[model samples]
Target: MTDLQFQCTGVRPEPFGAGPTLLFGLRIEEADHQPVHAIALRCQIRIEPARRQYEPEEVGMLGDLFGEPDRWSSTLKPLQFAHASITVPGFTGTTHVDLPVPCTYDTEVASASYFRALSRGEVPLLLLFSGTVFTGRDGFRAEPIPWHKETSFLMPVDVWRSMIEQYFPHTGWLRIRQDVLEALRRYRSARALPSWEQVFEELLATADAKGGD
Candidate 1:
């Protein structure tokens, strides 16, 4: 079995008041060059002020298009799983579609781990687990894809650094611990966290500046 591969084609950073947010656009491809029957996509965003989690409002427009409660679970199956077919546009071969995989976690433990890593001045990397895609009737008798568990999209440490440098050079780099400290400071100050849109503006401004040079 071959592993699934993801490529980061573009990284966009937008500003939110005092800081910025990162958005990554990705492309998924099969390793064997064989046509894929379907694809499963999942993403995770890790940040602090541990009290804050992904809110209903946070998903924004994507929520409207994809259905709410993006989180995966044993009880809720993906819409793709319900439908047996996916249409890939412009592709001559089989049409590949996307399935939303369910994710499970111990929120307390996960949050603790995130803070510990950040406290160490490390860039926290969230694991996006996409279960193996199957192809067959009833969505139950399908075979496992090669890259199912091993394949994942990594938000590389370098990419984060590049974003900070290109879009937020003024803010400077801090240890994960420092980041946590800052989050605490902001929280204590009663300042609202910046929205993703604000971060986008900052990223655009930086890109525009560089383009002129």
Candidate 2:
């Protein structure tokens, strides 16, 4: 069996990607410095909230996901961030590769919600690695990578913010059902609202007036 080890060096935003993506720099090493033909690697990235501390503002925002901060000792658990796969070319001793992790801005996602709650800090990540390893020089041999093969990384919040800014700029994203969207559209059309911003402003004003009365 080949003794393989993994390490996460750094992460960066993919500027030209079709969607929001983070490319994590991964380093792979063989203890015996044996020749590796190739590796079909699968990685599961998880956000470990318990690994880091949170701010009051962030805690308030994360209430919907983890409940009150007082009970966070038990509520804080690993949040699944992404699953990525890569095919590493043949190498000897050691090699480096980029693992592309696709991301989403949908606040409904637990990972996204946790990310949004953070003001400024690194996101604690636990990367679980698996899949097949191809080795041997004369003849090809396939072996299953153990589930215990994993690594941890600290991803900067700025990297995530910059990636989101590249796509959404200063705006945030919201997902609504088709029926609810139709109703909003109807409301906007009835008032001749020029933009969705005005529609929301008008609705808030109306609610405020009702509350005052």
C-alpha lDDT of all candidate models, in order: 0.38, 0.93
lDDT (C-alpha) at residue 56 in model 2: 82
* Alpha-carbon RMSD of each model: 17.5, 1.1
Q: How would you encode candidate 2's per-residue C-alpha lDDT over 88-175 as one tens digit per residue?
A: 9999899999999999999988999889889999999999999998998678899898999999999999999999999788887789
* Model 2: CA > 4 A from native: none
In model 1, the runs with Cα more than 4 Å from the true position are: 13-22, 43-126, 134-141, 145-213
TM-score (all chains, Cα) for each model: 0.29, 0.97
In angstroms, how far off is 16's CA in candidate 1?
A: 14
